[model samples]
Target: MRDITMYQSNGENELFVEQSVAQLPQLSGDTVTATIEIDAGQTYQEIDGFGASFTDSAAYLIHQVLDGEQRTELMSKLFDPQDGIGLSFLRNPMGASDYARTVYSYNDLPENGTDPELSGFSIAHDEADIIPLLQQALKLNPEIKLMASPWSAPGWMKTSGSMLTGQLKPEHYQVYADYFVRYIQAFAAHGLPTYAVTAQNEPLYEPQHYPGMLMLPEEQLVFIRDYLKPSFINHGLDTRILCYDHNWDRPDYPLTVLEEAAAEVDGVAWHWYGGAPAAQSEVLAAYPGKEVHFTEGSGGEWIPPFEQAFSNVMRTGIEILRNHSKSFVLWNMALDEQNGPTVPGFGKSTCRGVVTVNQQTRELTYTLDYYALAHFSKVIRPKALRLDSAASNELVRSVAFRNPDGSVAAVLFNDGEAEETVAVKLQGEEVLTFSMAPKSAVSLKVDSK
Candidate 1:
């Protein structure tokens, strides 16, 4: 008999696991009621994992506010598969992001000077909070994959001569490429090696207050093909390069890069702030050989009523995975009560992290984003493949996965306000029948026999 482990969400029971139901005889039916069909035999993208970012602000909260024991507990909840959500992928900033305590970069230079040799490059600022926090998370889940993205090329490398808005100077192209090499080497020296790196964060959007560099598709193509690729080869670094770390609204950016510098890029990273999730599949259809990654989206102070936040994340996870994205990552792992320790005048102050740590009370509160992420990260692991699954109607949405252990995990979300009775059929055989609460997310796991 195959046992089923189910987790349900209403309001109070956010991702709460219900008692397991013992297996029963498979039902024979010609006409089925509401049903979700799972075809494990048909598989799509191989999942890398699901997770959030580990920013300086988040690191500060973990290191300064939480005591040693509390820190351990929180880290376990965030990283450990057995003890917590088992997030297997993490996004790291190459330097300061809007979420950082202060705005800075690894290679800050005087306005009049440029670091052609990059002699002054350093990651000293990260050691204080970012490195230690990452080390602790690694201890909890050594297999976690870290991908870094730069908010801006250092001030001197840009035309603006500041960390804010600027474009990379034409002459500094090779030097900027070397800058990335130095960053990878510096992090490796500290025992935190990055697995992948995006060319720029929100490449098209350059804000006036914080660190941002606008790299047009043509410029990015030239840099990757002529400079960055050669630098990586010379250094013998195998870190994967992802392009167009921007919104789905601009699929042409990635498509253009793929057309011109396909040899230099491994995949495309997308942000959900402006486009539809289906746009990812469009890119995949155009270039089936390339990968699609959903890199950033978040729930926070700007999001209303916790339930809506939960639903938004759950819905997004289902849609992206169904659309061929191998990985889904949210932003900001943790933050203080004020929604930050954010860089003033840089980004949205109302932005929220996955979890909030009260500055005064030093207490931790897990946001809806945490539970939303847990529904997938807790069951679907790294290296798993997305199995084909389809709901009978729009009211119910789901994505199925075949794990390395040969088990099957299907995450289902009910959109309606009333309860839903869903009969799950595996390979045309009725495996189980369960009721889903209105506006709930569920992760159903079953052993493959």
Candidate 2:
């Protein structure tokens, strides 16, 4: 019988994989064996942390979040490094999102007149989903970074006085800034301080079907420089400001805003909806100094099942690496079969979720999306540096990381049908052949020799 073995070493440990070369053992068809090893002097990449967010709705649907044992279990599964992926970053909605049961903001339907002095304001409305999720997340990973973005502003602040298709009234610019300050302060008071805030989600698209708003480039610049940034500074808040929480097709939007903000804001956040992955490079090229982030993208019902699984993983993992993004965040982590808690309700017939929660059984099964996320999150620890690597669009997509321990982690994906052999080159002279399954992904960690 022919056999094949794959070995990986990190200065501290060695990992080996052994299996039969043929599909099955010709003489003895009943058995198969595998071996593993750990060695010293070799190191892998240092990890930052890996994690998912607790959106407004996930907090409510997860029946026992506040309970101590349940909270511990949830936190452990999502944040504890030994037991879970140890997620270190989260994306929170400044107000309610499509995931919420209804549409509402902190200061909507105000009891008093809209005042810039911040008389009628509070995140009391978010106590339902936002607070519980943040508290639980922070408890699990105290170093977790929180990113807050609004799906829509308070209805009264919009042009139509509605959550959909309304732009912020120019007169309310300062008031809008105070709106952010109030939310940050309120959240901090609850022991869940946020790390950053995006001006708006999909600032270009106003979903009439769901609770969404539109903010123009000029308006965004005005808000960030004239309002948001200054407000944060005045309040002595360290929460950072991020611009352009939209797609790559509009790189100029954020670039212009950045030119206007002129270092007042921290970075640029982009989503994938309008076009190809290369769109990210456009932004990076224009503003090389600013950090680029892939804030939101996910598998939806429209794509076929096969493509969904394969593309989602490849898109998020390889695309993010290709674009030189700082991080990648997916939409709704968990959802029921029906995809409820959606604001105006999901437009598509099928719902997308990484982990489909079987309400009756309370069982969680990993979908293509989950596996795709795990391909990176499982191995590429947070804060892991994106080292240099090479791959084409057709053969295999990969990114290399230098771990804290000096070992390296490389995640590779082969979307083709036939098994493909890839050449993995590390350091200067070390090279190995890596064979990946058709339409599969493999993460190899090579410790420093």
Candidate 3:
């Protein structure tokens, strides 16, 4: 008999640990309800972990608003595995993102001036708020993996000479690469070394208001193969470079980069703003050697009643992991009551963070995104491999994993209107059976026998 710990979420039970069953019924074909067989023998991509981003706005809320005890409690609730949701991965902005308090970059320069030598490049802007918050987060979970992505390069590096809408200038490729090297080195100096980086965030779409830069597939390939790769080697930085931080609508973008600059790139990063999650699997099927990562998704004011947010996030998370995404990241970790401290002209005002902090009262409210993340981040440790699992129908969606510690975690979602009695079978043995309430997400963990 194996002890099984079950955590469930519907509307009422928010990641609630409903029970701890000590045994399983004898395997009998007639007794089995809906059997979800977990095949540990077969494994897929190694999971990096699950988490959300530490955006500028998120960091600001943590640093400026919350008191010492409240901040400590919040951090513990977020990063502590035993005490809270063990978020083992995080995405950091290389500079000002749309969620930032203001628009800025590391290598800002005066009009008509060029810093080919990168003498003026500095991460000083991030030092004020972002770094301190990151430092505390690292203190909570030293093993957390951080992946940085820049919304835009410095104005001088772009053809438009502004951080709004433009493409990276061909002449500034080498210098821009150097800028990345310096950014990584600076974060290391601050004791928060970056683990990986995407070349650009949403490279295909460049918004006219917020910080954004358009870099087509061919342009990204050249930048990686000729400039970024060599720059990392020269600077002795092993930070992995992921390409095409864009939507799934066009698989050709990443496919082209992989076809051309595969040697220089580590993998592909994708966002859920447009297109289907299955596109990730398409890229992986073409290049099985490379990795696939779900970089950013968000929930906010746009979602009504909040429970729907959890269901949506859970469905997306399961779909992506089932499709071979090793890492899953949501957008902002924290935001104010109004869903911002957003920069003027930046779209997505309705986009809320995983958690909302009251600027005036210093109160924190955890959204469905947090509970949805907890379903995965709490049990699935880094290096856990995706195990083979299947559902009987679309109403019952599931993805299983074999943890590094020899435990198996299966996350199941019952999207239908009626409760589902699921029999989770391991090696054809009915290990446990439970009723997953309708419109609920549940994670069941069992020790390997």
RMSD of each: 2.2, 6.9, 2.0
* Worst 10-residue lDDT window, candidate 3: 23-32
Of 2 and 3, the candidate ahead on TM-score is 3
- Regions of candidate 2 where Cα sits further than 4 Å from its true position: 1-52, 64-74, 110-115, 344-349, 392-394
lDDT of 2: 0.66
lDDT of 2 by residue, 239-307 (tens): 878898888777788878977786787777877777656767776677766666777876666676664
What value does the lDDT take at residue 116 in candidate 1? 93
**lDDT of every predicted structure (CA atoms):** 0.86, 0.66, 0.86
Error of 1 at 268 (Å): 0.4
Clash counts for all predictions? 0, 30, 1
User: Judged by TM-score relative to the true structure, which candidate is superior, 1 or 2?
Assistant: 1
Error of 2 at 89 (Å): 1.5
Clashing pairs in 1: none
TM per prediction: 0.96, 0.84, 0.96
How does candidate 1 score on lDDT? 0.86
